[model samples]
Target chain A: MKTVKNESSKGSPRPAHVLQKSRLWLMYPPRLITTPVVWQLGQKHKVITNVRQASVTDEIGIVCLELEGRRADIKAAIRWMTNLGISVEPVEINIIES
Target chain B: MDKNTGFMKALKCRECGREYPLEATHVCEFDFGPLEVVYDYDRIKHSLTRAVIKSRPQSMWRYRELLPVAGEPTVGCQVGYTPLVKADRLAKRLGIRELWVKNDTVNYPTLSFKDRVVSVALSRARELGFSTVACASTGNLANSVAANAAAAGLKAYVFIPSDLEQGKVVNSLVYGAHVIGIRGHYDEVNRLCAEIAGKYGWAFVNVNMRPYYAEGSKSMGFEILEQLGWTVPQHTVVCMASGSLLTKIHKSYQEFMKLGIVAESRYKVHGAQATGCSPISTAQKAGLDFFKPVKPNTIAKSLAIGTPADGFYALKVMKETGGAAEDVTDDEVREGIKLLAETEGIFAETAGGVTVGVAKKLIASGHIPQDASAVLCITGNGLKTLDAIAGHVGQTREIKPSLREFEALLDKENKLINA
Candidate 1:
């Protein structure tokens, strides 16, 4: 619900939720598309539910996600991605826990 | 002159395939996906031919059938047909066979390849009933828009990052464009340009006028194939910032194949980027289905897009064509500039260096075959990005103009030359 700049067990990754939207800006020189990487990551994280991709431009692409898992596990999976040199940003959804 | 009607059907959404009237916008109203210029291959096949095209003047105009501009071109008609130099010496240094350089460094008027796109945009702007051409750019686009607009006798408005290189700023100012220096990164400046385009009727070339503008890039692919004995390359490497060039080249290859001109699509594309500004490449390597946004930090300022507009499509092409994207370091970029100059005698800017540097990396990693015919696109002239190599390009030897002064440094000079 709130952005806290903290990591998982290593105090490097903050909490990440399932069914929340996030983004990653990668620097891989071999490609400019993000779908392949997202598909590849979904294979690793058991909580991943769905991934949809949209083109940003000829030089950019965006991915929308619906993940289902523990917040810590999802955050750890995201940090694992960062360790791969693929930058990811977690965009929080406005929660109304009525 | 024959009628070239293949390019005027309508602009189609790359994602949804929804068509729109021939206009300047690059995105669709729904789903936020980008739009690309669509052509009727059946008409082009009937209209354009190699003998016919070869008979025409040597420029990007040779493929006029595929371009969006209507009627005779009036401004910067000397555009296109940049040289494709064989980099044998550079090839030997990199241990690759059959490497060529598609040099847009000497692009007319302004020194960058942006001239090619801007000329097309201006021509179509005139045809589409617009009198003003504008854009928000970091550097090259500003120069091209201003120069082409001035040549076309139209008013110009160019927006750029406030801290852009003086050389680029001066280049645009000299062309008499109404220059605006926004205090922000290229992304922020680009956002402002989008807002301005919505409010004002000014034809922002990269924003609203992109369909026609992007058609200009197809010439790069056309030239590469035509110059290479009417065959496509085994691999083509282009530096990626906004990812337009990479996708357009892919489209060009497709067009050629569809027209029965290329016979088949065998070209592999490699994208080059600075590590600090390599969002697409990072996504590609991380094996993601979509890109993660980046905060750019790189010496290849020409290609420092933190959020590339076509990054998604560029990635898609890489997958579809068995291509790869890679990033290089700032030091490697400088070395790449020196290497290209020393071996190929092509003193390209930082972005070109990124292509060369990343090409070397891809080659070493066995991504590109040793014997594959590869073309490294040098899109901009070194003069435009002078600041990138100002203190490092050529060695400055202080000496008097005399025989004794000449003889005084003979040993050092000889060793340097021979070494």
Candidate 2:
């Protein structure tokens, strides 16, 4: 399945870049709909796990996700989500350090 | 001096044992598995003793040797030490062998378990050099995040559904938090917070600081075992919203057993969810590996998170421990609350009612043994959700202070008594 792998839980960890980073987060405002908002970016990718929502707001809300999957789906999911009222954006979040 | 032992060791990832300098972070970078604060149990084993903790203070911090903070504690100093009331009557009513109520209803600052977590989140936010902290909450969490942030001298931004209980909204505002009501469900609101946290540096307690904040819930399990003479119960029935508390309590049990604080045993962990929002329980029943998030519609607003962060993990633990999950109706939730209050004098919020109602269901269905030792985790106070039981609690009996009035009332009482 096409998906958007969030560096955090949505998609595959960014191919160990020059920075050799471990985690990244995609954040949004509290909202009802999620995953779909970033559906295109993660179409082929699968979210290994997700942080889902940071807080809940109303009407037009936001959601943050950490996913994993193929690179193609991850890109498409983000593109598709923007059409669904989600302001698709990348986030640099650190959940833990071990 | 901060005791130099494993108790205050650096944080570690649960999915991967990557250790980081103690910072307020939650997710790991490698596989993105959630991180948790791991302790040095050896030091805790040697330092913390029943007698020593009992003599230190009547607070949650008394178990400092087992907690994961360095130096002096800066938050939740007045929390914990809640009632560990033996629920004999509740047991009798449910026909269970043993049931204990971890009555956090009287938790200080606010009467919910959120106080315990928010206290840690705000303090750790300050430690991480953040000037503001925020959260997207169902109701009780909003009340707590606002109050603790205010107390810790940090600007608090809280988001909640517009239709949240008035009591919860007022509670957040009264604490001087920047409370915003969204005109949608909690899941949507939470999505917004995640976005803002990325753009802004303000610490989102449950988002970035979730690892430590969640650790605060372990105190619930620790308190229960400590109150039970340092032994883990065979079965524990806990209320679920985000499923963090349930998973953490189980973590607490394993931690205690590993440290030789308690003997190892196969402890069953039962989860309770509101029928309006029972994704985890429903998934468990359907034997689905993943939880399908739902739009929550329940009077128990505290336990109303449609998409729980730890819902999957909660199911994993329940299955691994040979436990089960159940959901109760709104009517049963109220009855559960009233049943506990009337029978045990413990006024719990709607979540507690859900737990009591479900625990009874579990027993009736022969899921839990009739004579098993169990715990019903009452995570919040009922006063916060008074709207759920409006007009059902009691009615005022008006009477004039006259001898005739008294004589008539007395005659009615006597007649009823005789009849």
Candidate 3:
């Protein structure tokens, strides 16, 4: 029964302050495909960026990224990525039946 | 636990191909990809013949072997078998050779296609020993879950956007289900429901019980095939919410073809969306494999899911089938509703209007050739969302109950026509 709230399911145990985990879909434009945006995000912010799934072509790149950290830090990291022309969206799962 | 699991083999991950027990689970733990139910089609091909299906009752459960239920359906047994209306007048108006409407608006109990999914989900929930069920909906899914859960004597908690239509809200509330109104968009409510479903053990139909719930949509496609004399339509224009219905419809056609029921034929499965929430359509138009999520602002609330779960798959189906996708404005949606009502006398909800509007566009742009035949899936009834067309349908003329007044009014109308 793994819930989304459990941040310690995958990696090393974090402090209680680093509580939030967000699953995001990061779309990289063709120009940014060669850029190490995920590494840059982890270097700049107090967030752990884990790539769950990725498919990169010459035209575009899409990565299912899981970010674990304080809620504000994750939000700030997302804002920074968006500022750099990355389309940051919440990962879509089974939310619709019809 | 049921020893016999019907024709279903196991829940398989769409990405990783890892199999899981057929239970109330939706996503793969390792890769986070959605799980789908795989079936033993060989056994199904032997048993589910056209004669066997024709001998059964006229309901979705007639195709029970293909549905994911272990035993008899205790929920909505009379959910599907909606009409496949040949819209000749609408076809002429849209400049298409032939047009058909898979009218799920008059579906049993719920007056929407959600009844099909809820029926399968609740029945599977009971089979899995779950006493409570829930779902996060824009409107139609909430009504179906509330109604079907009430009928099945299961406790239900339906979460929806607070700003849904009054008719839809009342439809759920009247069933005595706990309808939680979240003051946010559908995407926000969906995120909250994901958290709730993870914490609680309740069977959220579109979350934990999604693979079974989604398989129910195939019944709609099955009925369309059967009603069209066991032939797949050349074009199927389905409105997109999470884009699940369009993909399932394509799957249905493929399943029937695989079973040797329908002769192999080339068909296109098009997708429709409101311009306000046209994520999948926008991506298809831009020739992108992935869609960018958008905040929804559509009058078609039922199809306003900003992040469609099956969007990628829907795009794949369209690309593979040589189908096109289109989106329409709110005003065009209203016009579509009116056009269907005036031409075919079938009043569909906003999502249906989106289907019709997009069908017209696809025909006009020659994406769907003018001579090609098509079927537009009208998923919900218009009466549920009267607010969307309340001020737009035009005003009624007030007249006293008098022969003299009626004659004068007729005379003035006749004079105007003559002039």
For every candidate, what is the interface RMSD in angstroms?
16.5, 10.9, 5.4
Instruction: State the lDDT at B180 in candidate 2.
Output: 75
Name the regions of candidate 1 deviating beyond 4 angstroms: A1-98, B1-6, B185-187, B412-419
TM-score list, all predictions: 0.80, 0.80, 0.89
The two-chain DockQ for each candidate, comma-separated, is 0.03, 0.08, 0.24
How much of the true A–B contact set does each candidate keep?
0.00, 0.03, 0.22
Least lDDT summed over 10 consecutive residues: which range in candidate 3 chain B?
Answer: B184-193
Clashes of each: 60, 76, 0
State which docking tier applies to candidate 1: incorrect
DockQ (model 1, Cα): 0.03
What value does the lDDT take at residue B125 in candidate 1?
A: 80
By lDDT, who's the top model here? 3
lDDT of 3 by residue, B1-419 (tens): 23468889999999999999998888777777889999989989888999999999999998898899988899998889999999999999999999999999899998999999899999999999999899877678888999999999999998877776676678889999998888864444555666666657788898888899999999999999999999999999999988889999999999999999999999999999999999999999999888876778999988877768889999999999999999999999999999999999999999999999999999999999999999999999998888899999889877999999999999998999999
The top-ranked prediction according to TM-score is: 3
Runs with alpha carbons beyond 4 Å of true place in candidate 3: A1-23, A27-37, A40-48, A56-61, A67-91, A94-98, B184-188
- Binned by DockQ into CAPRI classes (incorrect, acceptable, medium, high), candidate 2 is incorrect
